[model samples]
Target: MDQPGLATAATQLCGISHPVFQAGMAGIACPELAAAVSETGGLGHLGALRLPPAALARQIAETRALTDRPFGINLVHRGGPAMFEHLLAIAIKARPRAISLFYGDFARVIPRIRAAGIVAMVQVGSVAEARKAVADGADMLIAQGVEAGGHLRGQVGLMALVPAVVDVAGGRPVLAAGAITDPRVVRAALALGAAGVWCGTVFAAARESNAHPAYRQRLVEADTDMPRYRRGLSYGWPWGTPHRAIPGRGGLNPWRLMGGGLRRGDKSALAGRLSLYAGQGVGQIHDSLPAAEIVARLVAGLRTGSDSPPSPQGQEA
Candidate 1:
Protein backbone atom coordinates (compact mmCIF):
# COMPACT_ATOMS: atom_id res chain seq x y z
CA MET A 1 0.00 0.00 0.00
CA ASP A 2 1.06 3.59 -0.54
CA GLN A 3 1.92 5.93 2.32
CA PRO A 4 -1.03 7.59 4.02
CA GLY A 5 -1.61 11.02 2.50
CA LEU A 6 -2.01 13.33 5.49
CA ALA A 7 -0.64 16.78 5.97
CA THR A 8 -2.36 19.18 8.33
CA ALA A 9 -1.70 22.59 9.83
CA ALA A 10 -0.34 20.71 12.80
CA THR A 11 2.13 18.76 10.65
CA GLN A 12 3.37 21.88 8.88
CA LEU A 13 3.65 24.04 11.95
CA CYS A 14 5.31 21.27 13.98
CA GLY A 15 7.60 20.18 11.12
CA ILE A 16 6.42 16.58 11.16
CA SER A 17 5.69 14.75 7.90
CA HIS A 18 2.47 13.12 9.08
CA PRO A 19 -0.54 14.29 11.09
CA VAL A 20 -0.01 11.68 13.79
CA PHE A 21 0.61 13.01 17.32
CA GLN A 22 1.50 10.50 19.97
CA ALA A 23 -0.30 11.09 23.27
CA GLY A 24 2.00 11.74 26.23
CA MET A 25 0.90 8.90 28.39
CA ALA A 26 2.32 8.97 31.93
CA GLY A 27 4.67 6.21 33.12
CA ILE A 28 5.12 4.06 30.02
CA ALA A 29 5.28 6.88 27.47
CA CYS A 30 8.97 7.76 27.78
CA PRO A 31 11.84 9.26 25.77
CA GLU A 32 12.80 6.10 23.88
CA LEU A 33 9.24 5.57 22.69
CA ALA A 34 8.71 9.24 21.85
CA ALA A 35 11.96 9.52 19.93
CA ALA A 36 11.17 6.36 17.99
CA VAL A 37 7.91 7.83 16.77
CA SER A 38 9.44 11.20 15.92
CA GLU A 39 12.12 9.48 13.88
CA THR A 40 9.32 7.90 11.87
CA GLY A 41 7.75 11.31 10.99
CA GLY A 42 5.14 11.59 13.73
CA LEU A 43 5.17 14.20 16.45
CA GLY A 44 6.49 12.61 19.66
CA HIS A 45 5.52 13.81 23.10
CA LEU A 46 6.82 13.10 26.56
CA GLY A 47 4.23 12.77 29.30
CA ALA A 48 5.86 14.75 32.12
CA LEU A 49 3.20 14.43 34.74
CA ARG A 50 4.37 14.88 38.35
CA LEU A 51 8.00 14.68 37.32
CA PRO A 52 10.32 16.70 39.47
CA PRO A 53 12.13 19.53 37.70
CA ALA A 54 15.45 17.68 37.59
CA ALA A 55 14.03 14.44 36.22
CA LEU A 56 12.02 16.35 33.66
CA ALA A 57 15.11 18.14 32.41
CA ARG A 58 17.06 14.92 32.23
CA GLN A 59 14.39 13.14 30.19
CA ILE A 60 14.20 16.09 27.78
CA ALA A 61 17.94 15.99 27.23
CA GLU A 62 17.89 12.24 26.70
CA THR A 63 15.11 12.41 24.16
CA ARG A 64 16.86 15.24 22.35
CA ALA A 65 19.98 13.15 22.14
CA LEU A 66 17.97 10.32 20.61
CA THR A 67 16.36 12.15 17.71
CA ASP A 68 16.79 15.47 15.92
CA ARG A 69 13.18 15.25 14.81
CA PRO A 70 10.58 17.54 16.35
CA PHE A 71 9.31 16.40 19.73
CA GLY A 72 7.26 18.01 22.51
CA ILE A 73 6.44 17.52 26.15
CA ASN A 74 3.03 17.35 27.83
CA LEU A 75 2.46 18.99 31.18
CA VAL A 76 -0.92 18.14 32.65
CA HIS A 77 -1.95 21.46 34.19
CA ARG A 78 -2.87 20.90 37.81
CA GLY A 79 -4.79 24.20 38.11
CA GLY A 80 -2.19 26.47 39.62
CA PRO A 81 0.13 29.16 38.33
CA ALA A 82 2.95 27.66 40.31
CA MET A 83 2.48 24.30 38.64
CA PHE A 84 2.28 25.83 35.19
CA GLU A 85 5.26 28.09 35.72
CA HIS A 86 7.36 25.25 37.12
CA LEU A 87 6.76 22.86 34.22
CA LEU A 88 6.89 25.66 31.67
CA ALA A 89 10.31 26.70 32.88
CA ILE A 90 11.64 23.16 32.46
CA ALA A 91 10.12 22.79 28.98
CA ILE A 92 11.30 26.20 27.81
CA LYS A 93 14.78 25.48 29.10
CA ALA A 94 14.73 22.22 27.08
CA ARG A 95 13.36 24.10 24.04
CA PRO A 96 11.17 21.43 22.49
CA ARG A 97 9.44 21.78 19.11
CA ALA A 98 6.07 22.08 20.88
CA ILE A 99 4.29 21.96 24.23
CA SER A 100 0.87 20.39 24.85
CA LEU A 101 -1.30 21.53 27.77
CA PHE A 102 -4.19 19.78 29.41
CA TYR A 103 -6.84 20.97 31.91
CA GLY A 104 -5.35 24.19 33.20
CA ASP A 105 -5.72 27.94 33.01
CA PHE A 106 -4.49 28.55 29.44
CA ALA A 107 -4.81 32.27 29.92
CA ARG A 108 -1.92 31.93 32.31
CA VAL A 109 0.26 29.50 30.26
CA ILE A 110 -0.32 30.02 26.51
CA PRO A 111 1.44 33.38 26.43
CA ARG A 112 4.58 31.94 27.92
CA ILE A 113 4.65 29.01 25.48
CA ARG A 114 4.16 31.40 22.57
CA ALA A 115 6.65 33.87 23.94
CA ALA A 116 9.26 31.11 23.94
CA GLY A 117 8.62 30.57 20.19
CA ILE A 118 7.33 27.08 20.76
CA VAL A 119 4.06 25.89 19.22
CA ALA A 120 1.31 25.36 21.79
CA MET A 121 -1.33 22.60 21.65
CA VAL A 122 -4.15 22.20 24.13
CA GLN A 123 -6.21 19.03 24.70
CA VAL A 124 -9.88 19.65 25.48
CA GLY A 125 -13.07 17.61 25.73
CA SER A 126 -15.68 20.31 25.31
CA VAL A 127 -16.55 23.23 23.05
CA ALA A 128 -16.38 25.67 25.92
CA GLU A 129 -12.86 24.52 26.69
CA ALA A 130 -11.94 24.72 22.98
CA ARG A 131 -13.17 28.33 22.74
CA LYS A 132 -11.34 29.23 25.91
CA ALA A 133 -8.12 27.64 24.65
CA VAL A 134 -8.21 29.53 21.34
CA ALA A 135 -9.08 32.80 23.00
CA ASP A 136 -6.13 32.24 25.29
CA GLY A 137 -3.84 31.71 22.24
CA ALA A 138 -3.53 27.98 21.66
CA ASP A 139 -1.71 27.26 18.37
CA MET A 140 -3.36 23.83 18.09
CA LEU A 141 -6.41 22.19 19.64
CA ILE A 142 -6.71 18.46 20.41
CA ALA A 143 -10.29 17.25 20.75
CA GLN A 144 -10.51 14.37 23.23
CA GLY A 145 -13.60 12.17 23.39
CA VAL A 146 -15.18 10.24 26.26
CA GLU A 147 -14.03 6.81 25.13
CA ALA A 148 -10.41 7.74 25.66
CA GLY A 149 -8.24 6.05 28.21
CA GLY A 150 -6.61 7.85 31.16
CA HIS A 151 -8.10 10.40 33.50
CA LEU A 152 -11.20 11.78 31.81
CA ARG A 153 -13.19 14.65 33.33
CA GLY A 154 -16.42 14.64 31.29
CA GLN A 155 -18.60 12.40 29.14
CA VAL A 156 -18.76 13.94 25.65
CA GLY A 157 -18.33 11.25 22.95
CA LEU A 158 -15.61 11.60 20.26
CA MET A 159 -17.92 12.13 17.26
CA ALA A 160 -19.76 14.92 19.06
CA LEU A 161 -16.64 16.48 20.55
CA VAL A 162 -14.55 16.78 17.35
CA PRO A 163 -16.83 18.98 15.20
CA ALA A 164 -17.72 21.17 18.16
CA VAL A 165 -14.07 21.71 18.93
CA VAL A 166 -13.32 22.31 15.24
CA ASP A 167 -16.11 24.90 15.01
CA VAL A 168 -14.71 26.67 18.03
CA ALA A 169 -11.10 26.33 16.85
CA GLY A 170 -11.71 28.89 14.09
CA GLY A 171 -9.29 27.20 11.65
CA ARG A 172 -6.51 26.41 14.08
CA PRO A 173 -5.22 22.84 13.68
CA VAL A 174 -7.28 20.32 15.62
CA LEU A 175 -6.18 16.71 16.31
CA ALA A 176 -8.64 14.12 17.56
CA ALA A 177 -7.73 12.19 20.74
CA GLY A 178 -9.76 9.34 22.30
CA ALA A 179 -10.89 5.96 21.03
CA ILE A 180 -9.02 6.27 17.74
CA THR A 181 -6.94 3.11 17.32
CA ASP A 182 -8.18 1.77 13.99
CA PRO A 183 -7.85 3.08 10.44
CA ARG A 184 -11.60 3.61 10.32
CA VAL A 185 -11.37 5.69 13.46
CA VAL A 186 -8.55 7.73 11.95
CA ARG A 187 -10.53 8.22 8.75
CA ALA A 188 -13.57 9.24 10.75
CA ALA A 189 -11.57 11.82 12.67
CA LEU A 190 -10.13 13.28 9.48
CA ALA A 191 -13.64 13.27 8.00
CA LEU A 192 -14.98 15.10 11.03
CA GLY A 193 -12.61 17.99 10.27
CA ALA A 194 -9.77 16.97 12.55
CA ALA A 195 -6.38 18.09 11.35
CA GLY A 196 -4.89 14.80 12.59
CA VAL A 197 -5.18 11.90 15.03
CA TRP A 198 -3.59 11.49 18.49
CA CYS A 199 -3.16 7.90 19.54
CA GLY A 200 -1.99 6.23 22.79
CA THR A 201 -2.98 2.57 22.89
CA VAL A 202 -1.17 1.63 19.69
CA PHE A 203 2.07 3.24 20.76
CA ALA A 204 1.82 2.08 24.34
CA ALA A 205 2.37 -1.41 22.99
CA ALA A 206 5.41 -0.47 20.94
CA ARG A 207 8.57 -2.35 21.82
CA GLU A 208 10.30 0.87 22.73
CA SER A 209 7.63 1.65 25.29
CA ASN A 210 8.69 1.24 28.93
CA ALA A 211 5.62 -0.74 29.85
CA HIS A 212 6.41 -3.69 32.12
CA PRO A 213 6.76 -7.07 30.43
CA ALA A 214 3.53 -8.18 32.03
CA TYR A 215 1.88 -4.97 30.95
CA ARG A 216 3.15 -5.48 27.41
CA GLN A 217 1.84 -9.01 27.39
CA ARG A 218 -1.56 -7.81 28.55
CA LEU A 219 -1.73 -5.32 25.70
CA VAL A 220 -1.08 -8.10 23.17
CA GLU A 221 -3.73 -10.27 24.80
CA ALA A 222 -6.05 -7.38 25.51
CA ASP A 223 -9.73 -8.04 24.91
CA THR A 224 -12.60 -5.65 25.68
CA ASP A 225 -12.23 -5.85 29.49
CA MET A 226 -8.66 -4.67 29.31
CA PRO A 227 -8.96 -1.09 30.51
CA ARG A 228 -10.32 -0.12 33.92
CA TYR A 229 -10.81 3.56 34.74
CA ARG A 230 -10.04 4.70 38.24
CA ARG A 231 -13.18 6.65 39.07
CA GLY A 232 -13.48 7.91 42.66
CA LEU A 233 -10.17 6.90 44.14
CA SER A 234 -7.62 9.56 45.01
CA TYR A 235 -4.46 7.93 46.25
CA GLY A 236 -3.00 11.33 47.18
CA TRP A 237 -2.10 12.48 43.64
CA PRO A 238 -3.25 11.70 40.04
CA TRP A 239 -5.26 8.87 41.57
CA GLY A 240 -8.74 10.35 41.88
CA THR A 241 -8.64 11.64 38.31
CA PRO A 242 -10.77 8.83 36.82
CA HIS A 243 -7.94 7.78 34.53
CA ARG A 244 -8.51 4.69 32.32
CA ALA A 245 -5.93 1.92 32.28
CA ILE A 246 -5.29 -1.83 31.75
CA PRO A 247 -6.80 -4.17 34.26
CA GLY A 248 -4.86 -4.95 37.43
CA ARG A 249 -2.38 -7.87 37.81
CA GLY A 250 -3.46 -11.38 36.81
CA GLY A 251 -6.59 -9.93 35.28
CA LEU A 252 -8.14 -9.74 38.71
CA ASN A 253 -11.50 -8.02 39.19
CA PRO A 254 -10.93 -4.25 38.86
CA TRP A 255 -12.71 -3.07 42.00
CA ARG A 256 -10.88 -5.70 44.04
CA LEU A 257 -7.53 -4.47 42.76
CA MET A 258 -7.00 -0.99 44.17
CA GLY A 259 -10.55 -0.09 45.08
CA GLY A 260 -9.75 2.73 47.52
CA GLY A 261 -6.63 3.93 45.75
CA LEU A 262 -3.18 3.37 47.29
CA ARG A 263 -3.08 1.56 50.53
CA ARG A 264 -1.37 3.53 53.26
CA GLY A 265 2.47 3.17 53.17
CA ASP A 266 5.54 3.65 50.92
CA LYS A 267 3.30 4.94 48.09
CA SER A 268 5.68 3.39 45.54
CA ALA A 269 4.87 0.01 47.07
CA LEU A 270 1.47 0.07 45.39
CA ALA A 271 2.67 1.67 42.18
CA GLY A 272 2.63 -1.58 40.23
CA ARG A 273 -0.95 -2.12 41.32
CA LEU A 274 -2.40 0.53 39.07
CA SER A 275 -4.21 -0.59 35.91
CA LEU A 276 -2.34 -0.50 32.57
CA TYR A 277 -4.26 2.17 30.65
CA ALA A 278 -5.33 1.63 27.04
CA GLY A 279 -8.17 3.25 25.10
CA GLN A 280 -11.59 1.64 24.51
CA GLY A 281 -9.83 0.21 21.43
CA VAL A 282 -7.68 -2.17 23.42
CA GLY A 283 -8.90 -5.23 21.54
CA GLN A 284 -7.59 -3.68 18.33
CA ILE A 285 -4.03 -3.84 19.68
CA HIS A 286 -2.51 -7.32 19.30
CA ASP A 287 1.24 -7.09 18.93
CA SER A 288 4.48 -5.64 20.31
CA LEU A 289 6.35 -4.24 17.34
CA PRO A 290 9.05 -1.59 17.21
CA ALA A 291 7.80 1.98 17.41
CA ALA A 292 8.89 2.65 13.83
CA GLU A 293 7.07 -0.41 12.51
CA ILE A 294 3.92 0.50 14.44
CA VAL A 295 3.95 4.01 13.01
CA ALA A 296 4.50 2.71 9.50
CA ARG A 297 1.54 0.35 9.77
CA LEU A 298 -0.69 3.04 11.25
CA VAL A 299 0.20 5.48 8.51
CA ALA A 300 -0.37 2.77 5.92
CA GLY A 301 -3.60 1.57 7.48
CA LEU A 302 -4.99 5.09 7.61
CA ARG A 303 -4.04 5.66 3.99
CA THR A 304 -5.47 2.33 2.91
CA GLY A 305 -9.16 2.08 3.87
CA SER A 306 -11.47 2.76 6.78
CA ASP A 307 -12.76 -0.84 6.81
CA SER A 308 -11.94 -1.69 10.44
CA PRO A 309 -8.29 -2.40 11.38
CA PRO A 310 -6.76 -5.65 10.12
CA SER A 311 -8.69 -8.38 11.89
CA PRO A 312 -7.97 -7.98 15.60
CA GLN A 313 -6.62 -11.05 17.39
CA GLY A 314 -8.18 -10.01 20.67
CA GLN A 315 -11.39 -10.70 22.56
CA GLU A 316 -14.12 -8.67 24.33
CA ALA A 317 -13.80 -7.20 27.81
Candidate 2:
Protein backbone atom coordinates (compact mmCIF):
# COMPACT_ATOMS: atom_id res chain seq x y z
CA MET A 1 0.00 0.00 0.00
CA ASP A 2 2.93 2.33 -0.57
CA GLN A 3 0.85 4.37 -3.01
CA PRO A 4 -2.21 4.12 -0.75
CA GLY A 5 -4.76 3.58 -3.50
CA LEU A 6 -8.46 4.20 -2.97
CA ALA A 7 -9.44 1.12 -0.96
CA THR A 8 -12.93 2.33 -0.06
CA ALA A 9 -16.29 2.73 -1.81
CA ALA A 10 -16.30 6.48 -1.31
CA THR A 11 -13.95 7.03 -4.23
CA GLN A 12 -16.38 5.38 -6.62
CA LEU A 13 -19.60 6.64 -5.04
CA CYS A 14 -18.39 10.25 -4.91
CA GLY A 15 -16.51 9.96 -8.24
CA ILE A 16 -13.25 11.13 -6.73
CA SER A 17 -9.68 9.86 -6.91
CA HIS A 18 -9.18 9.51 -3.16
CA PRO A 19 -11.27 8.71 -0.09
CA VAL A 20 -10.55 11.99 1.68
CA PHE A 21 -13.13 14.78 2.00
CA GLN A 22 -12.70 18.43 2.80
CA ALA A 23 -15.57 19.31 5.13
CA GLY A 24 -17.61 22.25 4.00
CA MET A 25 -16.61 24.74 6.69
CA ALA A 26 -19.22 27.50 6.26
CA GLY A 27 -17.46 30.80 5.60
CA ILE A 28 -14.03 29.15 5.55
CA ALA A 29 -14.14 26.61 2.73
CA CYS A 30 -13.65 29.03 -0.13
CA PRO A 31 -13.63 28.19 -3.84
CA GLU A 32 -9.85 28.16 -4.18
CA LEU A 33 -9.52 25.76 -1.30
CA ALA A 34 -12.24 23.45 -2.61
CA ALA A 35 -10.80 23.44 -6.10
CA ALA A 36 -7.36 22.71 -4.74
CA VAL A 37 -8.58 19.55 -3.09
CA SER A 38 -10.37 18.42 -6.25
CA GLU A 39 -7.24 19.04 -8.28
CA THR A 40 -5.37 16.72 -5.92
CA GLY A 41 -7.64 13.72 -6.72
CA GLY A 42 -9.84 14.10 -3.62
CA LEU A 43 -13.38 15.35 -3.34
CA GLY A 44 -13.61 19.09 -2.57
CA HIS A 45 -16.65 20.69 -0.96
CA LEU A 46 -17.67 24.31 -0.70
CA GLY A 47 -19.33 25.23 2.57
CA ALA A 48 -22.61 26.99 1.73
CA LEU A 49 -23.27 28.76 5.00
CA ARG A 50 -24.09 32.46 5.46
CA LEU A 51 -23.24 33.18 1.85
CA PRO A 52 -25.64 35.27 -0.19
CA PRO A 53 -27.39 33.68 -3.16
CA ALA A 54 -25.30 35.60 -5.66
CA ALA A 55 -22.13 34.86 -3.71
CA LEU A 56 -22.91 31.16 -3.63
CA ALA A 57 -23.53 31.18 -7.38
CA ARG A 58 -20.26 32.93 -7.93
CA GLN A 59 -18.40 30.48 -5.73
CA ILE A 60 -19.76 27.53 -7.64
CA ALA A 61 -18.92 29.11 -10.97
CA GLU A 62 -15.44 29.97 -9.78
CA THR A 63 -14.81 26.48 -8.48
CA ARG A 64 -16.10 24.95 -11.69
CA ALA A 65 -13.72 27.06 -13.66
CA LEU A 66 -10.82 25.80 -11.55
CA THR A 67 -11.40 22.08 -12.07
CA ASP A 68 -13.84 19.99 -14.06
CA ARG A 69 -13.61 17.20 -11.46
CA PRO A 70 -16.76 16.41 -9.53
CA PHE A 71 -17.14 18.35 -6.26
CA GLY A 72 -19.88 19.11 -3.74
CA ILE A 73 -21.44 21.75 -1.48
CA ASN A 74 -22.78 21.32 2.05
CA LEU A 75 -26.08 22.89 3.06
CA VAL A 76 -27.71 22.95 6.46
CA HIS A 77 -31.27 21.59 6.25
CA ARG A 78 -32.28 22.60 9.78
CA GLY A 79 -33.06 26.17 8.81
CA GLY A 80 -36.46 27.66 8.00
CA PRO A 81 -38.32 25.94 5.23
CA ALA A 82 -38.32 29.15 3.26
CA MET A 83 -34.57 29.48 3.65
CA PHE A 84 -34.08 25.87 2.67
CA GLU A 85 -36.19 26.36 -0.43
CA HIS A 86 -34.24 29.40 -1.50
CA LEU A 87 -30.92 27.67 -0.89
CA LEU A 88 -32.13 24.56 -2.59
CA ALA A 89 -33.01 26.54 -5.68
CA ILE A 90 -29.53 27.99 -5.67
CA ALA A 91 -27.98 24.56 -5.20
CA ILE A 92 -29.95 23.03 -8.05
CA LYS A 93 -28.84 25.87 -10.27
CA ALA A 94 -25.21 25.20 -9.33
CA ARG A 95 -25.64 21.50 -10.05
CA PRO A 96 -22.91 20.15 -7.83
CA ARG A 97 -21.79 16.54 -8.21
CA ALA A 98 -23.11 15.77 -4.72
CA ILE A 99 -25.04 17.55 -1.99
CA SER A 100 -24.62 16.81 1.74
CA LEU A 101 -27.31 17.94 4.15
CA PHE A 102 -27.05 18.22 7.91
CA TYR A 103 -29.53 18.70 10.79
CA GLY A 104 -33.00 18.62 9.23
CA ASP A 105 -35.71 16.56 7.58
CA PHE A 106 -33.47 14.94 5.05
CA ALA A 107 -36.30 12.58 4.13
CA ARG A 108 -38.15 15.46 2.54
CA VAL A 109 -35.11 17.09 0.91
CA ILE A 110 -33.50 13.97 -0.51
CA PRO A 111 -36.26 13.50 -3.08
CA ARG A 112 -35.88 17.04 -4.38
CA ILE A 113 -32.15 16.56 -4.87
CA ARG A 114 -32.63 13.17 -6.48
CA ALA A 115 -35.16 14.71 -8.85
CA ALA A 116 -32.38 16.93 -10.05
CA GLY A 117 -30.24 13.83 -10.65
CA ILE A 118 -27.77 14.77 -7.93
CA VAL A 119 -26.20 12.38 -5.47
CA ALA A 120 -27.43 13.32 -1.99
CA MET A 121 -25.72 12.44 1.28
CA VAL A 122 -26.78 13.14 4.85
CA GLN A 123 -24.53 13.91 7.79
CA VAL A 124 -25.81 11.92 10.74
CA GLY A 125 -24.45 11.35 14.24
CA SER A 126 -26.28 8.18 15.16
CA VAL A 127 -27.12 4.76 13.80
CA ALA A 128 -30.81 5.65 13.81
CA GLU A 129 -30.19 8.72 11.75
CA ALA A 130 -27.98 6.77 9.39
CA ARG A 131 -30.67 4.14 8.91
CA LYS A 132 -33.29 6.81 8.30
CA ALA A 133 -31.08 8.58 5.77
CA VAL A 134 -30.44 5.41 3.77
CA ALA A 135 -34.13 4.51 3.86
CA ASP A 136 -35.01 8.00 2.65
CA GLY A 137 -32.99 7.43 -0.55
CA ALA A 138 -29.75 9.08 0.47
CA ASP A 139 -26.83 8.05 -1.74
CA MET A 140 -24.35 8.14 1.13
CA LEU A 141 -24.01 8.91 4.86
CA ILE A 142 -21.44 10.93 6.74
CA ALA A 143 -21.04 9.69 10.32
CA GLN A 144 -20.18 12.85 12.18
CA GLY A 145 -18.71 12.34 15.65
CA VAL A 146 -18.83 14.87 18.48
CA GLU A 147 -15.18 15.69 17.93
CA ALA A 148 -16.22 17.46 14.74
CA GLY A 149 -15.84 21.18 14.64
CA GLY A 150 -18.73 23.60 14.11
CA HIS A 151 -22.26 22.45 14.88
CA LEU A 152 -22.45 18.81 16.02
CA ARG A 153 -25.63 16.75 16.34
CA GLY A 154 -24.63 13.99 18.80
CA GLN A 155 -22.18 12.89 21.49
CA VAL A 156 -20.67 9.68 20.08
CA GLY A 157 -16.92 9.41 19.53
CA LEU A 158 -15.48 8.37 16.17
CA MET A 159 -13.84 5.34 17.72
CA ALA A 160 -17.23 3.89 18.70
CA LEU A 161 -19.54 5.43 16.13
CA VAL A 162 -18.20 4.37 12.72
CA PRO A 163 -18.74 0.62 12.97
CA ALA A 164 -22.15 1.02 14.54
CA VAL A 165 -23.26 3.32 11.75
CA VAL A 166 -21.77 1.03 9.13
CA ASP A 167 -23.54 -1.95 10.58
CA VAL A 168 -26.84 -0.11 10.66
CA ALA A 169 -26.36 1.37 7.24
CA GLY A 170 -26.45 -2.15 5.81
CA GLY A 171 -23.98 -1.82 2.93
CA ARG A 172 -24.62 1.88 2.31
CA PRO A 173 -21.40 3.88 2.04
CA VAL A 174 -20.46 5.74 5.21
CA LEU A 175 -17.85 8.48 5.63
CA ALA A 176 -16.45 9.24 9.06
CA ALA A 177 -16.09 12.88 10.06
CA GLY A 178 -14.72 14.60 13.17
CA ALA A 179 -11.13 14.84 14.35
CA ILE A 180 -9.77 12.77 11.46
CA THR A 181 -6.81 14.93 10.52
CA ASP A 182 -4.24 12.29 11.39
CA PRO A 183 -3.35 9.62 8.80
CA ARG A 184 -3.36 6.91 11.43
CA VAL A 185 -6.86 7.98 12.36
CA VAL A 186 -7.89 7.79 8.70
CA ARG A 187 -6.59 4.23 8.52
CA ALA A 188 -8.50 3.42 11.69
CA ALA A 189 -11.76 4.87 10.38
CA LEU A 190 -11.44 2.75 7.22
CA ALA A 191 -10.74 -0.21 9.44
CA LEU A 192 -13.96 0.59 11.29
CA GLY A 193 -15.90 0.42 8.01
CA ALA A 194 -15.86 4.07 6.94
CA ALA A 195 -15.39 4.46 3.20
CA GLY A 196 -13.80 7.90 3.57
CA VAL A 197 -13.00 10.70 6.03
CA TRP A 198 -14.66 14.13 6.38
CA CYS A 199 -12.29 16.78 7.70
CA GLY A 200 -12.92 20.47 8.54
CA THR A 201 -10.64 22.13 11.11
CA VAL A 202 -7.46 21.09 9.32
CA PHE A 203 -8.73 22.48 6.01
CA ALA A 204 -9.81 25.67 7.70
CA ALA A 205 -6.22 26.09 8.81
CA ALA A 206 -4.99 25.65 5.24
CA ARG A 207 -3.50 28.55 3.30
CA GLU A 208 -6.45 28.65 0.89
CA SER A 209 -9.13 28.75 3.55
CA ASN A 210 -10.87 31.98 4.49
CA ALA A 211 -10.36 31.56 8.24
CA HIS A 212 -9.17 34.65 10.06
CA PRO A 213 -5.46 34.85 10.83
CA ALA A 214 -6.05 34.70 14.55
CA TYR A 215 -8.36 31.71 14.13
CA ARG A 216 -5.91 29.73 12.00
CA GLN A 217 -3.02 30.50 14.32
CA ARG A 218 -5.05 29.36 17.30
CA LEU A 219 -5.62 25.95 15.66
CA VAL A 220 -1.90 25.43 15.09
CA GLU A 221 -1.00 26.18 18.70
CA ALA A 222 -3.91 24.33 20.29
CA ASP A 223 -3.64 21.12 22.35
CA THR A 224 -5.60 17.90 22.02
CA ASP A 225 -6.86 18.10 25.61
CA MET A 226 -7.12 21.85 26.05
CA PRO A 227 -10.46 21.82 27.80
CA ARG A 228 -12.64 21.67 24.69
CA TYR A 229 -16.14 23.13 24.83
CA ARG A 230 -19.42 21.80 23.42
CA ARG A 231 -21.26 25.12 23.25
CA GLY A 232 -21.55 27.42 20.28
CA LEU A 233 -20.47 31.04 20.48
CA SER A 234 -23.45 33.14 21.56
CA TYR A 235 -22.74 36.13 19.39
CA GLY A 236 -25.40 36.64 16.71
CA TRP A 237 -25.47 32.96 15.71
CA PRO A 238 -28.46 30.76 16.57
CA TRP A 239 -28.28 29.80 20.25
CA GLY A 240 -29.34 26.15 20.36
CA THR A 241 -26.84 24.47 18.03
CA PRO A 242 -24.01 22.74 19.90
CA HIS A 243 -20.50 23.26 18.49
CA ARG A 244 -17.11 21.89 19.56
CA ALA A 245 -14.29 24.40 19.55
CA ILE A 246 -11.39 25.75 21.58
CA PRO A 247 -12.03 28.71 23.86
CA GLY A 248 -9.91 31.78 23.23
CA ARG A 249 -6.56 31.80 24.97
CA GLY A 250 -3.57 34.11 25.11
CA GLY A 251 -4.17 37.55 23.55
CA LEU A 252 -7.09 36.27 21.52
CA ASN A 253 -10.28 36.57 23.52
CA PRO A 254 -12.67 34.65 21.23
CA TRP A 255 -15.64 35.48 23.41
CA ARG A 256 -17.61 38.36 22.02
CA LEU A 257 -17.08 41.49 24.09
CA MET A 258 -20.03 42.25 26.35
CA GLY A 259 -22.67 43.97 24.17
CA GLY A 260 -20.33 43.68 21.22
CA GLY A 261 -22.74 41.79 18.99
CA LEU A 262 -25.42 44.36 19.74
CA ARG A 263 -23.80 46.70 17.27
CA ARG A 264 -25.20 45.72 13.89
CA GLY A 265 -22.79 48.16 12.31
CA ASP A 266 -19.94 46.26 10.70
CA LYS A 267 -20.93 42.66 10.08
CA SER A 268 -17.32 41.97 9.23
CA ALA A 269 -16.22 43.05 12.68
CA LEU A 270 -19.00 40.99 14.19
CA ALA A 271 -17.67 37.84 12.51
CA GLY A 272 -14.27 38.32 14.10
CA ARG A 273 -15.66 38.09 17.64
CA LEU A 274 -16.88 34.53 17.28
CA SER A 275 -14.62 31.74 18.61
CA LEU A 276 -12.65 29.58 16.19
CA TYR A 277 -14.26 26.17 15.81
CA ALA A 278 -11.72 23.35 16.19
CA GLY A 279 -11.74 19.58 16.62
CA GLN A 280 -9.48 17.81 19.14
CA GLY A 281 -7.42 16.60 16.18
CA VAL A 282 -6.19 20.17 15.75
CA GLY A 283 -3.06 19.20 17.66
CA GLN A 284 -2.03 17.18 14.61
CA ILE A 285 -1.94 20.30 12.43
CA HIS A 286 1.48 21.88 12.82
CA ASP A 287 1.63 24.07 9.71
CA SER A 288 -0.68 25.81 7.25
CA LEU A 289 -0.19 24.71 3.61
CA PRO A 290 -2.03 24.49 0.33
CA ALA A 291 -5.12 22.29 0.17
CA ALA A 292 -3.52 19.86 -2.31
CA GLU A 293 -0.45 19.50 -0.13
CA ILE A 294 -2.62 18.85 2.91
CA VAL A 295 -4.54 16.15 1.01
CA ALA A 296 -1.31 14.57 -0.22
CA ARG A 297 0.15 14.51 3.27
CA LEU A 298 -2.94 12.90 4.71
CA VAL A 299 -2.98 10.32 1.89
CA ALA A 300 0.73 9.66 2.29
CA GLY A 301 0.35 9.48 6.03
CA LEU A 302 -2.26 6.79 5.50
CA ARG A 303 0.04 4.88 3.15
CA THR A 304 3.28 5.18 5.10
CA GLY A 305 3.77 6.00 8.78
CA SER A 306 6.72 8.36 8.48
CA ASP A 307 8.29 9.16 11.84
CA SER A 308 9.59 12.51 10.56
CA PRO A 309 8.18 15.80 11.77
CA PRO A 310 5.63 17.68 9.60
CA SER A 311 7.10 20.31 7.35
CA PRO A 312 5.56 23.49 5.96
CA GLN A 313 4.80 21.51 2.82
CA GLY A 314 2.55 19.13 4.74
CA GLN A 315 3.13 16.26 2.22
CA GLU A 316 6.23 15.32 4.21
CA ALA A 317 4.18 14.48 7.30
Q: Which candidate achieves the best lDDT against the true structure?
A: 2
Tens-digit lDDT string for candidate 1 (196-228): 888887777788886665556666777766576
- In candidate 1, which residue pairs clash? 150-243, 150-244, 151-243, 224-316, 224-317, 225-317, 245-276, 245-277, 246-276, 246-277
Each candidate's lDDT (Cα)?
0.76, 0.77
* Model 2 TM-score on a 0 to 1 scale: 0.88
Model 1 poorest 10 in a row by lDDT = 257-266
How high is the lDDT of residue 211 in model 2?
79
Which regions of candidate 1 are displaced past 4 Å? 1-5, 79-83, 234-240, 249-273, 305-317
In candidate 2, how many Å is residue 294 off?
0.9
TM-score to native of every candidate shown: 0.86, 0.88
Clashing pairs in 2: none
Model 2, 1-317: lDDT tens digits are: 12445766788877787888998877788888889888888888988866777888899999999999888988986446777678778997778888988888777889988898888989998878888898899988999998887778788998888999988887878999998777778778887889999998888888888776666766777778742555544433576567776654335554532111111133444334545577888878887777777788778656664655344334352
